[model samples]
Target: MEIALVGAGAAAVGLLDALATTSLARVRPGLITVFEPSPHLWRGRPYGPDLDTVLVNAPPAIMSIRHGDPGHYAAWLGESGAAHLDDLLGQPLVPRHRYGDYLAATAEAALRTLRANGWRTRIARARVTGVERRGDRLAVVAADGGRYAADQVALCVGGGEPRDLYSLAAAPGYVHEPYPLARTLAPIPADARVAVLGSGLTAVDVVVSLAARGHTGPITMLSRSGLLPHVWQRPSGHRPAHVTAERVATAHREHGTVPLGHLIGLLRAELAEAGEDFDAFAADLLAAGTEDPVRRLRRQLRSVGDPRIGRRVLQETAHTVGPYAWRLLPESGRARLRRHFRLATSVASPMVPVNAATLLRLLDAGRLTLVPDVRAVEATGGGFAVTAGDSAIHVDAVVNAVNPPPQAVPRAAGELVASLVSGGLAAFHPAGGVVPADPRVQVAGDLAGGGPFITSGIPGIAAQAARTADAMLTLARDESSEAPATLR
Candidate 1:
């Protein structure tokens, strides 16, 4: 049997690791091919060392390739003895490069194990242009006119491409992509006025990078809300105990509405009753829930009246949900929750003080300027014209911090995603993200009802890979008695 995996990001790495560690002596594939444009397969954009300011939003302990091993990443850090881990875990913030190194190391270890297991591994250093079903097999065409046939294909492409700004693109002093931040901003003068389009995590990274590089210029960040990511806070020991299925059902039974907030209060009360560590409890709940608890709470709120009950349900869901889901809460919900919770919440970075302090220091020293808005950009005689609301400002260069549209896959990894969608092999999820065959892994990074999956984050992606490998192995065992269907 032969297997092909595309886009060697976190998901692909996890899959490879699973294949290497599993008891595959009886059902191992004859060959495994990994398609990636990068020199290295596992170290995609997120783990690449190109940008120093791109920190992992999650803590090291929760960021590992293994499932049910919360401390795997932290343990690896200790064994590697990387000096930065101490500072990273010590302070509220950790450098992004360190995390990249961790991923690289993890990939290397997996590769070594695979080689020892006698599995033939091939890393194709080229772009995969398209994939098509050919009889019972899959055909992967490369940009350089090469092709590979596999029994199955798994697409683990990363995020989509950066968006293009018409005004910014035509302008003489505009920076389009922010990934290669140094190269994009290299031509700008040290003291230049700049405006960032978005105020999310990417925007913050750009700002932090500029400061580190000693770019003493007026910098203005613009967005719909102009809200930055919240900072990470010290773990609070406030576990809630009322998260049992029985309690949840009872609450639903008694009151027509499960006020999310009230549910949270009950959970907190239950945690206090159980006497479990708050941090551990919170992590466990987040790791378990597949759906967005907040959204569920909201739906329950609308279905049932009783203002008090509604508040309780919302609170409970909010306390138990993961950061990614919590971040999806409506802006109003976020604001209300912030006022009630004193503990470290993931709505935004809890370490905003550090980020705010850095930005304020730059502004007070005339190193940055606050711009009203980015009105328009046009080519000027020598440089570019930047309009801020009503006023026009001239600058030698401008960096676009606005996030690109969800399409236009970025890097080599996203090509397979585009192919899958265009081929009708996958469909988009109503609520952001591509659906995969398995919820744990995404197949072609598109939301379609099929197996061989891909996921958004490391934890989920890792889980998906392991699950896929297990499924494939099971199929391999069954193949001895039954003929498996091939791509028609």
Candidate 2:
């Protein structure tokens, strides 16, 4: 079997690892090629080398690339890697680059296994333009006019870059993308009054990294909703008693589809079992986004050690049951979830406690301010004028920290997807991502459609990788049985 993986990001790493570890001795060895344009393969954009302050935002529990093996990453870290630990969260919040190292190491190890097993592996340093279905095979087209043939193709392209909402790409003193903070933040003056556009994790990254680099100028986190991500608490290791995937499947089998209220009931039951009031906690969670920013931060900080397991359950189930429950929900249920998507995201993807404490310090020290109800950011004579509701401020520089909408196809991949759609090889899903119409083509990572909109973290992507890898091997087995001569 000839396999082609487009985009050497986390998803590619997972797929490679899955293929290497799975029992494939029965199948004939084949070729596996990975295509990535970035100099850093397997790291993706998020995990690539960046400022040391750009730490891995999620906990080790959710960051594992190997599905079903939560300790894979932690074991890799070992006791010696604890130097990058975050005392508040009690987890090693290593730099993003270090996570990239893990991904590279995993990919290399997988490649070694595949090679030892007589499978050929190659990394093509080029961006994939499109995939065309040839006679009984697929042809992957690269930007440099290179074409590679494969029996199976897995599109593992990661998420898109931050959206330039204010159209400030050409404007002076505007940072279009706050990545490789080493490069983006280097040109920025230490005392430059800066306004980061978005209150999500990316925005938080800018503020935190700035402080770490001794950026003493006034900073503003601007957003329409003016809500910061909730701070992550120390893990309670609380597994849900009610929101299991099996229960969701049972509901679907009995009711034909799961209702939003049924899912809520499951959550309520889980919380009540932990001696928590569902309605009251639910109310607070919903109201948190609109409350005073500093007050909410302080309250969340105080609750980091509260010993309540409600948030822990929600966080754990958000990954495990979220995708299954989402696909099984009725249109009405999905619509209701979309209505409060912002709040749901805040709760689901919270910042680490260390970052939260940093933000609180900046706010209390009068170095940082949160601006909600952001109206517009217009380029001014000297810098930029940011208007948020009844308040306005001028900043010397503006960083575009607004995250792209979930599953927003990258600019480059957009053309590639269009080509596939035109060729009838793939179709776009209403929810997100391009769905494969051909059995030989697979989709993984943020690009896979029909899941929750909040982009899949490492765990979800890892799960998708494992599933895709298995499907590819199954295809190989079936092909071998049908045409024994093809294997030789």
Candidate 3:
């Protein structure tokens, strides 16, 4: 059997590692080909040198690729003496580079194991341009005119490049898209005024890098919402004492299924019924509900209108439900959870303001500036012209921090749902971004309803890869079982 895996980022690595460790390595696919354009296969753009300050927001314990080994990553850190195991687990942040190294090491180990077993594994250092279905097999075409046939395929392509800066065709300033920060930050005049486009984690990393490099120039971080990420804080142990199946069932019965927005109402009802302080109850509930206390707190903030109420919910949930609260949602509940996210963004939480403190500190220190919004830009004088919101700011460099367009897989495995849909072999998902398949693991990661698969974080990407691998293995096994005796 020929198995093809697309992209060599964290997800791909996880899949490969899982395959290496499993019995499937011996009984299944004769050859495994991985399509990755980067020179460093396991370490993709996120872990590159340009993003030194990019930190993993998850605790090391929950960040490992190995299934059922919650403390694997933390143990790795402790054994390596990178830091004390307690310090590593106690803190809410881990350096992005360390995580990158861990992934690389894991991939290397898997590769060695595969080689030792005499299994054929190939890494194609070229871009995959298209995928086509050919009878019982699939054809993966490379941009450079090469092709590979696979009995199965896995599309694990990582995030696309950063979005363009603005609508202008050409501008004098540099519009950085996947631009190397080391190159951009080196040898700059200390008094230069730099404007960063987004206020998310990417913008934060850039701003923090600039400050660390002794750039005294005024930097402006502009965005649609102008909101930055909240600082990493150690979660305290506090939980809501109330949270029973009866309470949840009661809320669902009364509201006909509660959305996250109704969390406030549910809490209020519970409080009134129990005759207790809502804040105290919420604190205990959240603490008991979530393993990641900080994330639990964030979820509460996301559920309510009042900042105090949100904080209390998060604190209580963290103490009561543990980390499983977020994971315990059923598929229908998950869909509702996604909907609640869209609604929660409108109401400003007190915690939302905390997102900007780092940037604000830089502005106050005169190390960053808020540039006037640009209206238009035109090429002129052999350079480019830029219009701010109301003023014109001309510069030699500009970076586009906008989010990238969605990605599409040119080809998919012979039995993979995405491949079938792209090849007109299957139907598309109702939501449009997914290929129709088993709803649990077969996600669409393309613009047309497939998914980029993972989000913008390491933990998310790792989890997606693991889930995908499990699904693919299961599918392959079921197919093999139903095949002719000779084929099996």
Candidate 4:
């Protein structure tokens, strides 16, 4: 049997670790090749060493490389002596590069195991260009004119092209990409006025990175609502009164999908049960028209007393129902959720306290300007002029701090995803992702051109990895029994 995993991001790491250990001895694939476009395995853009202080959003325990060993990553940190950093804060968020190193080490361990079992394994440092089905086997083509035959192909390609606010392709000093911040912004003058175009997690990364690089000039973070993400407190062991798994299941059974109305009602019920008013809690978290919305939220949570419980209460509730809601909801329902996702994210996806604190420090020092209601950013002869509402500010440089571009898209999913869709091997679904691709070819992570329903957080991603491993094992076992003697 031959199994192929495409792309070497977090999803690829999870799949590779699982597939390496679970194959039955008889059914162990003769060859397992990983096609990774990046220079190294495991460290994708997010976890790559783009910035010095860009710490991981999740801690070690939750950011496990493999699903079965949930504590493996945290343990690896302790054994590697990297845990010393956590001494400052009892439970510390790891540096992004540290997580990348962990991934590389995990990949090394997995390769050793597969080699010991006499399973031929190789990492092809090239992007998979195409996947074409021929007879019972599949042909995996790489960009560098190499082809490998695999009984199964798993597309773990990450997201597609980024969602951009403006088309700055022709503008000088207009940077639409955010990674390799150390390199991208290296040419800017120290006192150059800079403008960043977003205010989410990625924006925090830009601000932190600039500060670390000793960029002393004023940096403006421009956005609508002008609200920074709230900071995360240590999570509490609290369960919701109304937004339980049982309730989600009930909603699915009764409504065919988790109705948007029912989901909202469940949230309101949870607030009422806790003697909290839903409107008040939301107002405090989504407090816009203020210079420091994030600080206001932190203060509000503290005022509630037992801040951890108060902060995590709504986040936990939304996450609990999210998977069910995404899978079961129709187009209209998903649309409804998307409309409020940013607001939901303000509470559901808070920045790590460290990043938030850094932002506050920068703000207090008057080094960072938070611009509200960004209308347009047009290229000027000298630089880019940003128009926010009726006001305008020209900056020498513009750094797009929006979400990173998706790794693949349907139309421009390069050769691999395009081949799969064009050859009828897969079909795209905004909510459902690619329709299972093929029964034999399991597509992990996001499959659609844009937003996918797959859970991307650590716990959910690890769980999905485990499931993919089991599926690979079952498929390998069945295929080995029927494969020709040459394949075996």
Q: Each prediction's TM-score against the native?
A: 0.70, 0.97, 0.69, 0.86
Backbone clashes for every candidate come to: 52, 0, 61, 6
| lDDT tens readout by residue for model 1, 90-163 | 42335656776667677677778877777678888878887766776667889998889876677766666656
lDDT of 4 by residue, 1-488 (tens): 78888877777777777867675666754788888767757776667776657778754555786875757887877755444343322355777877889888888788788778878888888777888888978898877788889887887776654456688877889877777777788888889999988888878888888888898999999988786766665644456777766888887888777767776687778777777777776576545445366467446334332533555666554433465456666778778766765666666656766666677788878998889889999888899899999999999999887764322453334567667778777776654456556766777665532332323555545556666778878877777777788977
Worst 10 residues of 2 by lDDT: 479-488
**Model 3 per-residue lDDT at 414:** 26
Best by lDDT: 2
Query: How does candidate 4 fare on TM-score?
Result: 0.86
lDDT of each: 0.56, 0.88, 0.53, 0.70
- Model 1 lDDT vs. the true structure? 0.56
lDDT of each residue in 11-100, candidate 2, tens digit only: 999999999999895678989999988898899889988888998887888788998898899998888567987888888898999999
**Which regions of candidate 1 are displaced past 4 Å?**
22-26, 51-54, 79-82, 85-94, 236-357, 363-366, 369-395, 404-408, 411-424, 428-433, 436-455, 480-488
Give the number of the best model, judged by TM-score.
2
What lDDT tens digits, residue by residue, belong to model 3 across residues 1-488? 67777677776777777777766732555788888877776766666555444555444544676654556666766655344222412443445666777778888888788767766888898877656777767777777889899766676665455656465335545556534567666645556656677655566667776777777766766654443343333333323334533455565677665444455555575455545577675454334322332343344334333323333344333322312233334456456544533122212111222233445567656666544344554545544456666666655445555545434322322233344466663455443333433211233122224332123233334445565667767767777788888886
Better of 2 and 3 by lDDT: 2
What's the C-alpha lDDT at position 231 in model 3? 32
Could you tell me which residue pairs clash in candidate 4? Answer: 159-406, 159-407, 159-408, 160-406, 160-408, 162-405
Lowest lDDT 10-mer window, candidate 4?
446-455
